[model samples]
Every structure is written in structure tokens, then in C-alpha cells.
Target: MDRERVVEWLEGGSVSIPKVLLKHYADIGLNEIEFLTLLHIHESIGSGNPFPTPIEISNRMSIDGTACSEVLRSLMKRGFLAIEQQDVSMMICEKYSLRPLWQKLASLMFETVHEEEEQERERSETDLYTMFEKEFGRPLSPFECETLSMWIDQDDHEPVIIKAALREAVMSGKLNFRYIDRILFEWKKNGVKTIEQARNQSRKFRQHQQPKQGVSSNEGTRKTTIPFFNWLEQ
Candidate 1:
């Protein structure tokens, strides 16, 4: 690892993180020490060898073996490093750099305080794609994956919400990705994604329409029925 090259690399890029990555970084908020530890590993292995042992990194960074090992695992998860240890040397690669797509994800770990958020993102990104490919019997296009990422980032929308919206749109015979965004945008604005909120909204809407329905049951009943599960459904 060239100390000079490591320094140059760090200083060179503006670190224009992808939105998903930025969200992960902001949520995880890696401490300076952890970030520095990752940098050390990058320098120690730069274009030279695969993954270096914790002891080697510990010696160079002047840290304890245990501490270095712990941090190394953390870095591996957070996408700063990749680790593959076999009967031989461990292969490590930097994922957060301008690396290939596979390595890029390897270097990332969401900085979320809530474990649920971290798990949720992982589930949507990994499992959703896996399921999609399995069901369709074809891999999603890169652009399609990007669209999924966009949907995830937009509004902090979870897969559950997105999936529910998709089901609704499909059932209503209005399913379209573009429209889905608009629907989600509106749902988020109204704070009505959950079933309880939807139920509450339905009750209120029905209450508002009660008088009109009483006046003209024929016409008014149709309008009143529209909100039977308005909030919950859409």
C-alpha cells in the first residue's frame, strides 16, 4: 500500500455518494476512528495483496489485535471492505470506491440507529430482487434495479408500503410504476400508509358524507361507499 496513493485517493474524490449510500452513511454515522481504520486497510492492501490479516493491520495501525479484528468485521459489513477467507489468504476489496457494482454494495453498511431500518433496506434490496428474478425467471435490468432504489430512497418508503400500493393499484386496474410514485407521494403527505390511519380516515370521510347520503340515498350511498375503506385501501 502506497501511503501517498491512499492519501491521494482520499483527497481526490468529492465522495458523491449515491442517495441510498448517503442515507446509509447518515443513518450509521461512522465514527472517525472506524473511518480511519477502513482507510488504513485500504492503504495496507492497495494493489498489492488481497485481504490482510487483522494482525498485519493492527501492527500498521498500532492497534490491538482484538480491536482491529472487531473493526474489520464492522468495516466489512458497512461496505468499506470485503472479506473472503478460505484455506489461503483472505481476499479483501473496497466496496465504496469506484468499484464494480458487486463490490460497491459490499463496502456499504447502513448507518441506521434502528435495526429495523437496516434490516428493511437489506431485505428490500436483496430479497426483493431475488424474488423478482425468481418469479419472472429473468434478471431485472440495471435501470429497473435503479428504479427500485429510487423508490426505496424516495419518501423513506418501505417495501411493505410500496408492495401494498402495488397490490392496490393492480386490483384497481391502475397499476403503473409512475402512478405508484404519485400514490405513495400522496399517501405520505396524508400520513396514511398504515391500516389504522386508513381506517380513521375512512370513518371521517363517511361521517362527512352521512348527511348527503341521508338526503338522497340513491346518489349519496354511492359516494358514501367510496370511503368504506378509503384510508386503508388507497
Candidate 2:
């Protein structure tokens, strides 16, 4: 190609396509011809002609008019294209709408995103099981796994809060799943939904108990001192 031709092509601007269309064209059951036909319609719309005739599309794409018509028919049958007649300059002309195409594309993209999110969540839940097994020094039984799943799926407890409760139970010499469940239950009952909240509650509980422990220790000391004095009097 000549430099001038290349410069002209470069200055002609670009066609914008949705990333979802590029990645999932085949997944959405669109053949190459059908995809190209859609692109031509999109370009026509950009060029201020919302509806381009089959001949116009074929001329631009180097395809025969008959083949372009077949593709358009197929796309229409698949609910991706629609035709409507409009009055243009007192003459009836067919106008094509690509709204169904956009709606189908949106649905496919949403399904793809939801599937990815579910897969990630499963992987995270698996990792939680692995962490629990390592901490407990044994593999979880079927019942234990069921319990964990219930917490994740039914109770809607976050993994971080559950892990925090587990750590608290372990530190208190109660390293069993039942004890951990009890801790989580109590926290949930008290509206502790986060790791930070659980930690704060634990700190407050310890602080509340410390004064009573101190008083008990002081009373024991007084009793011992009194016994020692009575022995001296004897």
C-alpha cells in the first residue's frame, strides 16, 4: 500500500465493539457471517442510516446479495434482528432494529459474570476448609463439612467471622467444632457480624472478668494471713 493510502485508512477512525461480543461471539451461537452482518448494521447505524439494505451490506462486505439475505433471515429467525416498514419520503422502506441482539448479549454477559463469581466463592470456601483442617490437625468428617456448608450457605456467616470464633475457642482450650459453633452462635446472637466486632466483644468480656478475679485473689490472701495470725496466738 502507498503511504498516502495507509495514512487515509489510519485517519478514518475506528469501529467500537463490545468486549463481550468479541469474547463470546461463538459462545452466543453466532457464525462469522452473522457476526459480520451485525457489524455492518452497527456501522450503518453509526453512519446515520439506522437501516441498511442487504445490497448495501453485501457491497461493503464483498459478499453476494443472495448470501447476505440468507444471513439476515437466519439472524431474524434467531431473534437477533427485526424488520419494520417506515415511511421515508412518501415511500415505504424497511428499517432494521438490533435491540434483540443487544438484549441477548447482555443476558449472556450477566450469566458469564455470575458463573465466575460462584466459582470464586466455591474456591474460597474450599480454602476455608483446608485452613480449618490444618488448624485442627485432622481432616473434617462428613458431619463437620455439612456444618461448615450450613454456616456458609444457610446462616450467611462470613468466613472471617467464623475463623475469628474458631481462634477464640482454640485459645480458650476448646478446640472442637462444637465449641467453635457455640462461639459463632453467641456472636451472631449478639449481632457480631465482623472479625473486628468479635474481637472487641472478646476484649470487653476479658476486661469485665478481670476485676472479679482480682477480688477473689485478694480475699484468699486475707484468709491465709488470718490463719497465720491465729496460729501465732495459739
Using TM-score, give the best candidate's number.
2
* Candidate 1 lDDT, 46-67, residue by residue in tens: 5455566778767766678899
Q: Weakest 10 consecutive residues, lDDT, candidate 2?
A: 225-234
Each prediction's RMSD over C-alphas, in Å, is 17.9, 9.1
> Candidate 2: how large is its RMSD?
9.1
User: How much does candidate 1 score in TM-score?
Assistant: 0.34
TM-scores of the candidates are 0.34, 0.76
Residues 32-62 of candidate 2 have per-residue lDDT tens digits of 8899999989888787797888899999886
Number of the top candidate by lDDT?
2
